[model samples]
Target chain A: MYRALKTKPWISLLAFAAPALVFYVIFLLIPTLGGVYYSFTDWNGLFRSYHFVGFSNYVEAFTEDSRFIYSLFYTLKYVLAIVILQNVIGLGLAVLVESRMRTKALFRTLFFMPNMFSVYISTLMWTFIFSTAFPQLAEKTLLHFLDQPWLGSSSMAFVSILLVSVWQGAGYLMVIYIAALQGVPRDLQEAATIDGATPFRKFLHITLPMIMPAITICAFLTLNGSFKIFEVVYALTGGGPGYSTEVIAFNIYQEGFARDMRYGYATAKAMILFLIILVITVTQVAVLKKKEVEA
Target chain B: MRKRSLIPSSLIVLLLIIVTIFFMFPIVLAVVNSLKSQGEMFKSVIAWPKALQWENYKYVLTEVHILRSLYNTFIITILSIVGIIFCGALAGYKLSRTPGKVSAFIFFLFLSSMLIPFYSIMFSLIQVASGLHIQGSVYRLPLIYIGLGVNFAIFLYHGFVKSIPRELEESAQMDGCGQLKTFTRIIFPLLLPITMTIVILDILWVWNDFMLPLIMITDYKSYTLVLLASTFFSEYSTEWSYILSILVLTSLPVILVYLVFQKYIVQGIADGAIKG
Candidate 1:
């Protein structure tokens, strides 16, 4: 056996790859294929038998299921908000922190601290702030506007979710942006200053182009991440104010696990999410990669 | 000239300071209010506690069995990381070294799976886990995480392996070192930098992950810190002080780890983002 293995490269490959492949097949690969297969079927999880029902699950999700449709639109709104705001604020904070000489590390640490906690933990913390702290702060201070029903009202709940997400997520993108900012050539910035390029102009022409790759990366990260938004909604609002704040992942969870054990139906919704993410991310990366090359 | 520049710089500093306060306020509020009595917290959430209520922490520690959750989390995280590194490094190294259509196709299979979001696979994965009787066991969840995580780890390792020259492995083989021996003895040690990057990323992920454990681990004894804290939060929803304490306590471990590994964690994120 040893002599045979020594001579045959395929044997060596099998030996090395078997451990990972076995587990991967059992857990990830099979499940992925199983999900796609189940999406076309009509098996409630309790039933052993399921019949193939092609595209009906998909059709129902888009046309028949209003809650799921609401969640789809809600998630898109969230992804758009998060992708734009997270990148902008992240880049802004990265620039600010990078500009400082003495306090760069301190500011970065402070800004990135919230990310160290779980989103659920952060949401719980913010829940306290929105519910209890803000109300009291409003009463005590002159800032009476702080007393709004942050999670109670539908519109405000969306804003509250967005706020908590950006607070937790932006720091991650900042770290990426900061790394990108460091790679920008110092001489170019100094030359811009010598040529009397205003700070804004320098950033627009010089700094922004240099960090296009980072922007692409940050955009991808936020887009991918916010689409899968679950814990924040799960903890903060529970898709509250009448499912107004429900996200795609949460909707799927509700359909599959919590409310209905309509495994086939939920699996269809999950596949829809996967396709949506795949299309959007591919488009984003393609556009950004083009921008990166041109820059 | 100096004075002219100083004004804008001071304004920038002020702006940064205000933003920093906003970023830190939730954590500071949680910490401060966690130390206050319920009535005091109600009266003034911003005010410092007149007397520090150590009992909140004591109550959570003693009554809530948070330490058990912490231990369970530690075990699962460590095991998952170890399993991922082991499986990932072996396959990644071998695949990168091997030259064939088979190797290329296998690598593609792993890489493409990364695009399949967890929500998509999760329902089926739960079914698989139950079919195999792998669910609800703290020991077995790491096996699932290994499955989910190895692809990314293999990606990182596959990329990193290209930087290492083939001569080292060639010479080891020439010196009568077996394939497994060469990997364990020589190649694995050289793979430390990327390994550190993987370790940092995986630790953060597996430690704080709430969803998988929530679905998998039904028994209270097997609850991860995040799951337990969330359960505790809902059970005592109106007890602000206690909930705040639980939040702070749950986060304390990760915070300490982050501070200790701050530089590496940042480097890991940058590396993972760029390469990934």
Candidate 2:
């Protein structure tokens, strides 16, 4: 057997890859395939038997389930808000920090510090701020607007979620943008300046295009991340005020584990989510890659 | 023109200062109020405490067994990282060097799964875990992490291995070293840069991940730091002082690690983003 394996290089390759492959197959690959198969059945997670249900799960989720449909739109809104706001603020901070002569490192560290905390922990801290600090501040200071129900109303809850997400996320994109900004050729900026170009013009025409790849990367990161947001909403509002802030992942978690144990139905919803993410991300990457090449 | 430019530049600095304060607000507030008694905190969340409340930290530390949770997190993180590095490095090295459809297909198999979101597989994954009797076991959780993490690690290692010269391995082979020995002695040491990248990134994920531990680990003894802090928060939801202290204690280690390895962490994020 050893001699035969020695003669065949592919067998040795399998040997080398076998350890990782074993774990990956058992834990990840099997789960993924099992998820897809279970999506076509009516397995409620407890029974030893289940029957195939074809596309009923998909049709029901689309045509019948209002909560699931609402979550889909809500998640899309979240994705758009996070992608745009995170990149803009991140790039803005990067440009501003880079302009600092001596305090650049200090600012970078301070900005990225919040991201060091777990999302759960960050949400806890913000909960204190919203529940305790804001009301007290409103009483003490003249800033009456700070007294509003930041996490109570539907609109405010949406805003509050976006606020925390951006606060934790923007700094990461800033690091990427800072790197991209540093990679911008100093000579080109000098040339533009010498030609009497305003700083804004120099940034718009020169810096922006030079950092387009970083923009694409940051956008991709935020888009993928925001679509699957679970912990913040889970901990913060608990999808409060009648599920107004329910993201897709949270809705699926509710279906599969928390509320109903319809593992099959939840798996179907999960597949839909996977397809949406796959399609949107692939399209974004293809379009961004084209732009990156042109730039 | 110089005078006019100075105005906007200074204005930018002023704006930055305000934003920095805003960014630091939650952390500063948490830290400040963590030291106040609940009554003192209620008086004014922003005001200085009249008396220090070290008891909040003491209560969480002793009663809640937060230190044990921290140790549990450390053990799981280190073990999973070692497993990932070992498995990922071997498979990535062999697959990169070997030329064939089989190797390409195996590599593709690993790479394609990176697109599958964790939520997509998590439900069925729980079923698999329970079937294997690994659910709720702290020591066995790293195995699942290794499975989930190795794909990305393999991708990184595959890209990094290309830069290593093949002659190093060939020369080791000629010296009568077996393939495994050659890999361990020659190729493994050279993969340190990418290995560091993987270790840093995985440490953050495993240490901070809340959902997996929440679902898998039913026993409080197996609770990770984040999980314990979360449970503590929900139970003592109204006790701002105790909850704030727990939050601070939980975050202190990560903040310290980030401060000590600031440059490497930043570099790791950039490298992972660019390469990945």
Candidate 3:
């Protein structure tokens, strides 16, 4: 028995993985596939009777209903702006803190403090800030951009969510980037500095390339996270100003849970979102992973 | 050059100060606003409160019954954290020790689970949970939580455990220690750093979790602090003072946690983000 145990290492591995595998198959993989299957038919939550309507559900989504496609486009815009801005701000903060400043730890705490709070709570607080705090403060000082209705319009609403998301997300990513920045060899930096290379030139060359791996991970996280964003949007705007802020995830949620619970349609919409995310992730990983290695 | 430095340096410092206030002003606003009566809060107190209101905190504990919700959240968070650590450590140990085709296959499945968006599986999960008669109970929540989070926890553990030298286990084996004894006595203590990482990660996520609980638990009896605060926000959005107050109190626990364990939490994020 001892000899057999020594030889069959895979048996123990298989046993260790059994619980996770069972959970995934039952909860994740099966449900997702079932969701796709349900999309083909209009099966309400309560009914055993089901009629297979073929591709009409998808057909309606693409042709008859413009809302899904429009939301997809809006969500894409929101994501692109957010992912790029969040990364830029986060990288900047990392660069700032990596300079060995005296207050780096204090600044890091202040920056990361937003991330510790839940989004729903933050949004509510911001409602007060935008409406009351900023405007009140502006009355007494030159920094009075607070009187504007930050969440009252579609375009500004978009900017409002983008700002909050970045504020919350950047600190977390800054920690990662600072770690990556530390891993950059001080010897090389010294060599460049001694050779009369300006700080800008050195950063543009050494820092950027060395940090590419961390950038890739941050991009992946921000991309997937932005795509899945619902709570912040829901809390901040309620997908309001005439549904201009409705992302697909929130749309599916509103479809399913609100009103009469059109679960079948919501599942179909969710599957569409699933495919969008899957395609985006696979493409980014395949293409960017190579670029990262090259850089 | 010295003359040129002073202006830009001051300007940069000024910019940073402005941005920091921009980042944290809402939290300050909420804290100040929560302390005032409805009329006073509506009038917008941007500075420190004239007098701190103990009643707001009392309101949350009593009227909101946030205490009970806190108890429920505590039960779920503790159980789920314990579950993840135990299962993740056990599985991680086995995966590190055993290498072969089946383990790789299982590992791949776990990896894929992380990518599959929650919205995709959530509908069917609800259906399945409803069918299984596990809805509204704490027992059901942990399984779903484990399904979603255990992969990341296991992944962290797997990486950390691989660095543990095999020699210690061999000596234990020489002392006639069984595999379980070697794992528990020799191996478990060394896992403190990784265990802390896993615990902090799970706590942050499980504490802040709203989406999962929103769908799974329908009863107000099982609602978490975040969820209850969210409900309060929606219902009393017009009551800016009340909304602001709840928002402040809602953020207190997480803010406190972050302040306390921020070193480990930041390090955990750095490791997870940069390494993988």
Model 2: CAPRI class:
medium
Worst 10 residues of 1 chain A by lDDT: A1-10
Name the TM-score of candidate 3.
0.93
Compute the lDDT of residue B42 as modeled in candidate 2.
86
lDDT against true structure, model 3: 0.77
Ranking by DockQ: 1, 2, 3
Extract clashing residue pairs from model 2.
none
- On the 0 to 100 scale, the lDDT of residue A127 in model 2 is 88
lDDT of 3 by residue, A41-106 (tens): 776666667778788777887887687888889999988998889999998888765553667788
lDDT by residue for model 2 over B104-198, one digit each (tens)? 99999999998788887888899899999888787999999999999999999999999999999888777777788888999999999899989
- The 10-residue segment with the lowest total lDDT in model 2 chain A: A1-10
What is each model's TM-score for chain A?
0.96, 0.95, 0.92
Off by over 4 Å in 2: A1-7, B1-7
Tens-place lDDT digits, model 1, residues B1-276:
111121268778988988898899999999999999999998888888999999988898887888889899999999999999999999999999999998999999999998788988888898899998888888889999999999999999999999999999888888888899999999999999899999998998999998899889988889999999889888999899999999989899999988888888888888889877
**lDDT per model vs. reference:** 0.90, 0.89, 0.77
Global lDDT for candidate 2? 0.89
Clashing pairs in 1: none
CA error at residue B96 for candidate 1, angstroms: 1.7
RMSD of each: 2.1, 2.3, 2.8
